[model samples]
Target: MNQSQQPDAADPKRRDILRWTVGLSAGLVLAPLAGCDGGSDDSFSATVDTLPEAPRIVAKNGLIDIDLEAAYAHNSVQLAASAQNAYPGESTQQATDLRSYNGAMLAPTLQLNAGDTLRVLLHNKLPGNDTKYSSLPYLNYQNSTNLHFHGLHVNPGIIRPGVYGDYVVDTPDAGVVPGASRQHEIHLPADHTNGVYWYHPHLHGSTTTQVANGMFGAILVNTPRNDFDLPDDVRDRVIFVHRLNLSDGGRSDNLYDYVNNKNSAFMLNGVYQPTIVMRPGEIQNWHFLNSDVFYPFNPVLDEHTLWQYARDGNSFDRVFRPVNAATSVQMDGRHWPGNVLYPGNRSSVLVQASQTPGTYYLRAAKAPSSTGEEIVARIVVEGRPVEAALPSPHRLPLYNAHQPITDAELAQHGGKTRAVILAMLNKDSDLLVQPIPAGEEWFIPPGDGVSLTDTVFATGNVGTKLAPFQSDLAVTQTIALNAVEEWTLYNLNGYPHPFHIHVNDCYVVKVNGEDIEPYWADTIPLAPNGTSDQPTSITFRSRFTDFTGKFVWHCHALDHEDLGMMELVEVRT
Candidate 1:
C-alpha cells in the first residue's frame, strides 16, 4: 500500500498520563467569592496533572451489580496544588462537610451495554437535614434523596417489583431518606438508544442542593464504537462540568452551589483549568456534560472543532456541527453562534488535535459583556505525532429515536398540543412553571389558560404554580403511551429556562413559530421573553414509546426546579 493507504492507529479508548492545566470560570455571582480560583496560563507550577476521571463500574457479563453509598465528606478534599479553588459548600475560608455518592465528589461513572442489568444497592449514609431556605416549608430536607436516571428510557414503577429505575415521586417509594438504603435495578432494553447519560438525586426539596454539591455522575451506555471501525488507540474522555462556590462570612453565594471533588471556582472533572495533553493527529471522544445547578455554558475551544456526535444520549444520522455551536473562539470582534449547554444537557463530540499546535483553551463567552469570558480548560498539543483519522459520527446506528420524529409519526397523535407557561408569579429570581395540560378551559383573562375565582388551586389548577414540589397533588398532565405529541414551551418570564424532560428526547421543531433544523435533545434553552406580548416559545415533538409511569419535565436550572418549575406527568397505557 502507498503512504496514503497506511491504516490509522488503534482506538484503545483509554487514557495515558499527560500534564495539563485548568482554571475556574468566574460567573457574575461567583466572581467575588473565587479569590483563589486555581491556575491560569501563568500558574504552570501550581499543579499539572491528568484529568481526574471518577472510577468506572463497568458491567460484566451483561450485569453491573455494585454497592453505591452516599455520605458526607467531612474533611477538606482538594488537589495537590495550593492554588486550587477551595470548595467548601458552606464557607470560603475552609473546606466544610459536603454530601457525595460513594464518597466521591463526582460519583462513579457507570459503563454498560444496551442489554445490561444495572443493579445498584444505594446506601444513604448522610445525616438528616433541618434547614429551610424558601417559602416552601420543606425545601431543606437535604437528607431525603432519590436517584433519577437522567436520560434512560426505563420504568418509573414501584420499588418492590424490581427497583426504582427512574421514579422520583414521594408516594409509593418515599425515596432513600437519611440512614435508609434502596436497591435499584434498571434493565436497558436490547435496543436502548445509547450514548452518554447521567444519574443524580431527584428528591424534590434537596435535588438542586445535592446535585450542586456534587451528587451527579455520567452513564455511558452502548457507545456505538464498533460502528466506527477504529483501532484501539483512541482516547475516550468524560468532561463533566460543574460549579463549586463558597460563602464568605454572612454573604453566601447562591444556594445552587454543589460541592464537587475539586474546589475550583469552576471545575472540569473536579479540577481547575484541566489540560488535555495530545499529539498531532490524535483523536479523542469527549462526553461533555453540563451539570451546573443553574445557568448554561457556551464552550469554545480556541482552535478546535467539536464534531457533533450525539446530544441528550441519542446519536445523529451523521456528523455535523451542531446548530449555533461556534467552530472556534473567533478573535474578530463579531458575535459568533453559541454552542450552549444548558443545565442538565450533554454533548458528545470528537476533537482532533491540530498537527502543529501550541496552547489552546476551552473557554466560554457568557453574556453581560463584563463577566462573559473565562477559560474552562487548557489543551496542549505537543508530543510525538500519532497518525489517526476521525470517522463519521453519523455512522453509528442507535436504537429507535436516533433520527428526527417524522411527519408520519406526528400525524398519529391528531393535532394535539399542550402548553406550559414559564413565568414568575412570585419574586423576580424565582421561576414559575404553570403546566397547562390540554383539555383545560382556556379562559382569556390575562392569565389566559384557566379562569379562577381565587387561588388556581381551588379548581385543581395547582394554585397558579407548584411550590417546593407540593408532593401530594394530582398530576393534571397525563400522556398517552405509544404516541408522539408536540409541546409548546413558552418563556413568559424575562429570563431563559433550560427545559428538560425525562425518559424521552424531543426534536426541536421551531422557536416562536419559526421553523429551524429539528435538533433532538433532552434539554433545550427556551429563549427569554423580554416582557414582550409575544413570549419566547419553543415547539418540539417527542415520542413516548416504551416504558410508562411517572416522570417529570422541568426547568433545567436545577434551583428553579427545586423551587417549583417542575411538573410531574403520568404516561398511561
Candidate 2:
C-alpha cells in the first residue's frame, strides 16, 4: 500500500496504547518504541509515502535570474498528533511549515552553462520576530536569512573600507530581514567546471536551524567536456537526500530538541522510498547530494555498480570503479569502494540498470551510527533492455583540472604552515581535549564540546581580521593572494569528521604520513583517533588563487559546525 494509506491501516489501538501507556510529559515515547536510531533496521517500519520528483529550472542564454524567497509553506507529509505535540511553541502549530526556495518543498534545480551569470533577488519573508519559544538561551536567527552558492568558484561578495560595513558576498549583508529584499550577483568564470552544485541558507549561527527547515536547492553547470554522453532518451535524476526531525515539528528554534530527541526521517526529494523507474541495462546519470546536517550517507544500489564520474561538482578524467584495498594508499582515503557521499558532499554516478529487470533497493549501507541500512529509494526495473555499451573511462574529458603544485611553485610561494587540531572541550574529557585559554573573545555555547583550535598560534594579535575566529586562541591562518601552503589537520575526536574549505580547493598529498595520488577536492575525510594506537592526520596543499577575501574551513557535519568546529582563513592581496 502507498504511504498515505498505511497510516489509515495502522491499528488505532496502537495510538491509544501509546498515548495512555507513555505519558505526554516525557517528550518522545514513540521514538524509542520506533527504534529512533535513524537506521533502516526491520525494527523501524519503512515509510510508505510515494516519492515526489523534484522540480527543475533551466537557465537560458547563459543567465538565470529568479526571485528566491525563504518563507513558510505546508508539506504534505502527515505526522501523528502526539509527534506534533512534542514540539514546544508555534512549532507545534507549524508542523507542516517549511522554509523553501520559491516555495518548493525541495527547491528547484537550476541548470546553467559554465560561464552563466546568476542573479537572484532573495526576499526574506520569515517572521520578523523569533519563534514565540525564542526565550531559550542560544543563537537562533529564524527571522534573519541569507544565501550561499555552494561549490561555485565565484566571488562571495566584496567588502569595502569604513564607508561600507563588513559585506561578505557569500553571506548576506545583515541578512534579508523580514519583508526585506537583497540582490546576489554571481558570475561563473568561463573556465568553471561542468558538474552538479547546490545553494542553501549560509547565515552563521542559524544555518543549522534554517537548513533543517529545508532551505536548499541544486545547481547544474553544463559544459562541453565529453562529446559522447548518455543516450538522449536516458533519464537523468537529481536526488537530494535530507533528514527531517518530526518530533519537534521541524522548527528552527527546537533543533536541539530534535537532536536530543533523535526523531528524524530520511527522505529523497522530501518523500520516503519513492520508486524510480528504469529499463533493463539502461545507463542513467544520478546526481546525489547529502543535504542532511549530520548524517553521512553511504549509498549502495542493491546489486548494481555505481561508476562515479565527479566529486564535489568537479568531474574527473575517468570513471572510478570501486575496489577493495587493504590500506588507504591504494585508493583515495576519502571515498570507500563505492562512492560514499558524506555530509555536505556531492557526487554524480552512472548507474547501469540490472539486466534482469526487477525491483531493487537503493540503500545507505553506512549512515549515522544511530541509523543503519536505511532504504533511500526504490528502483523498479522493467521494459525491454536498452542496447548500449558503457563509455570508455579514459575518453571522458577532465571538466575541472588543476595542475599539481610542483616543488618549484611550492618553494616560491609557500607561506606559513599551520597545524590545527579538532577536539572536544568537555571538562571530564581525557581524549586529547583542549580547554579554551583565558581572555579569548570566543564564547562556547552551553553544553558545547566540539571545537577546532590552532595549536601553534597564541591568543590575540595574530593572523588577519578578515579570517578571524570567535575565540582569541582560535588563530586564523593567513595566506597571501596566490600563496601556496600546506595544512596538517589532526583529528582528536572519537568519530570521523569530513573537513571542507570554502573559496579554494586543495590537493591531497598524504594521509597518515603515507603519500597517495594527488587529486583536487574541496572536502577530505579525516579518520578518527582510536584507542591510543591509531592517531589520525591528513596533510594537503592549497593555493589561494583567483578571488580573494574571507572564507571558512570547517567540519561538514552541520551540527559540529554550528557548535564551533569551524575556522576562518584570509586570502589577502
Candidate 3:
C-alpha cells in the first residue's frame, strides 16, 4: 500500500470534501442595520473579586431576551500581571455608572438533558469593533450579530442571523446569508447524546471577527453514560480558551488589531489569574475551544496530568489502544467513555483528580509562535486521598500513532464506527486583499499547478512567477472511516493549517512515514514549511461509532475558516 506521492494541493480527495461542504451549506449574506458604531479601550482596574452578575433574562414570544450590556469580569486576571491578555471573550465597555475592570458577556452554558426546547434571545446593545479603529470585518453592521450552534441538530428557520427575529423567523433559504440583524432558535432531542457542544457566530466573512470580538460559549449535553468512578482528586471542570488583541493605549483605544489582521493576547475562560481551585473528589471537565482569530492554540499542562474524557462530541472506551512516546495530537473529534463534552473544533482535556494535591498548568501544547503565551489555565488540586501519593512522571503511550480499535472495543458498540473527513480550502483570489465581490472570479494560470477557486491558501503562487498566487484553499482532505477503515491526512500546503474533524475521535498513526505514538485528538496543527524536522504528511485512523450528525472539519484558527478553511461532514446510518 504505497499511497505515498509528492504532496499536491490539487488532489481529488481534497476537492471532494470542498464540493460536499458547499453543496450542504448556503452562502451567508449581511443584513442591514444601524446602531452603535465603535468604542475606546481605556484601561481599568482588575475585578477578579467581583464576577459579573448573571444576565437578566426576559422571555418574550418564545424568545429568551438578554441584556447585551451585561457581561462577566475577572478582577484577578490582570494584563501582564496575572496573564498576558484579558479573557478571550470579555468586553471592556460599560453602560452603567458602576465602573470596574472591562468584562465579557457570559456565553450561556446550556446544561440540557436532551429533549429540551432551547430558546435564546440575544439583544444587540454591545457594539462590535477592534481596539484600533478600522473598517469592520465580516458583515458591515452597526455593532449587531447572532449565533451559530456548532454540532447541534437544530433547524435554521428559527436560527436566523443578525437582528432579533423580525419576521416569523423562518429557516433561511439555501441561498440566504447571515446578516447583522439576525437571531436564532434551537431545539435538541433528549437522545441527542451527552457530549461537549459549542455556539458562536456563523455569519460568513465576519465569523472570525465576531468570534474574536467576543461571541462564543459552551453547551453541555448531559447524559447518564458519565459513570467513571476515579480518584476523588480528578473533578471535571469546563475551561474555555480564547485569544484577544490589545494595544498599549487606554480604554476602547483599539489597542490591538483583531479583525483587521493584527495579532495580540490569549486568555482562558475570559480570565487569567491564580490556579482554579476545586475539591479533590470532583471531576473537572475542561470544555476547551480555540477561538483565536488567526492562530491555533495547542494547550499543554506543564505541571498537571489530564484524563481526557471526550473530543468533538463522541466518547471512548478504556483500554482501546496502547501508546509509546510523547506526540502532539490534534483534538478534532475524539471522545471519552461517556461523551462528557465536545471541544468543538477546539481541543479539551479532562483531568481526573489525582490523589496527590498539587499545582499544575494547562498550557498550549507545542505551539508555533513565541510571541503568544502557552499557559492558558492553571489547576490546583486541593484534596488528596489518604493512601495515594505522587506517581512517577510517566507519559501516556499515546504518541506517534493512530488510535486503533480492537474487536473487543467494537463489540461494546454492536459493530458500528461511523467516520467522515471534512475538506477546507481558501477559495478566493486577491490575497492580502478582499475578494472581487460576487459573480467575479480570479483567473489562475493554467498548467501552473495552482488553485484559484474554492480554497484559501496564503497566495496562489508556489514560489514561481508561473505560480504567482499562494494556494487559496483552506482545507483539502476528507475521508469516511468505516469500522475497519484507516484514515490518512496529507499536508499539501506550504504553511501549517490546524486540521480538525468532527463526530468521531482519531489518533495520529504516523507523521511523514515514521510511526509516532497512538494518542487521540480532534484537532491536529499541521506545521508550516512542510519541511524536515516536520513531516509533509500525517496519517490517522479511528473506528467511528456511537454518533451521527452534520459536523464540520476546519483549521482550528477561526480566521482561516472564515476566509474559507472550513467544511461540513454528516455521519449517517
Worst 10 residues of 1 by lDDT: 26-35
Top candidate (TM-score): 1
Q: Which stretches in model 3 have alpha-carbon errors above 4 Å?
A: 1-77, 81-103, 126-144, 153-183, 189-191, 223-235, 249-256, 259-265, 278-283, 319-362, 369-490, 500-524, 531-554, 566-573
lDDT of 2 by residue, 351-443 (tens): 888889677877766432326555666777766567777777776556433667666777889655666666543433333214434443233
In candidate 1, position 81 carries an lDDT of: 23
Using alpha carbons, what is the TM-score of model 3? 0.54
Please write out the lDDT profile of model 1 over residues 303-353, one tens digit for every residue.
677676677776666655642225433312121114667788888777888
TM-score of each: 0.78, 0.77, 0.54
Ordered by lDDT, highest first, the candidates read 1, 2, 3
Model 3 per-residue lDDT tens digits across residues 1-573? 111121111122422321211110111111111111122411111111121211111111222323222122333234332234322323343121110112544454444444554455444444343322322222232133345566554443323344322122121121123222333445554355455666665543445545655567655554211223223333234455554554333121221133332343455555543345433433444545555555545555543455444455444434322111133343222211121111235333454444556666555543343344445555555533334332222322222123465446546545433222222334343232354333322222233232333443232212211111112332223333344334554454544566665444566656555666445566665534453223355556555544444445565555455444554454455
Candidate 1 regions exceeding 4 Å error are: 1-49, 75-96, 131-135, 159-162, 171-173, 224-227, 248-264, 322-338, 367-371, 427-475, 530-532
lDDT by candidate, in order shown: 0.61, 0.59, 0.39
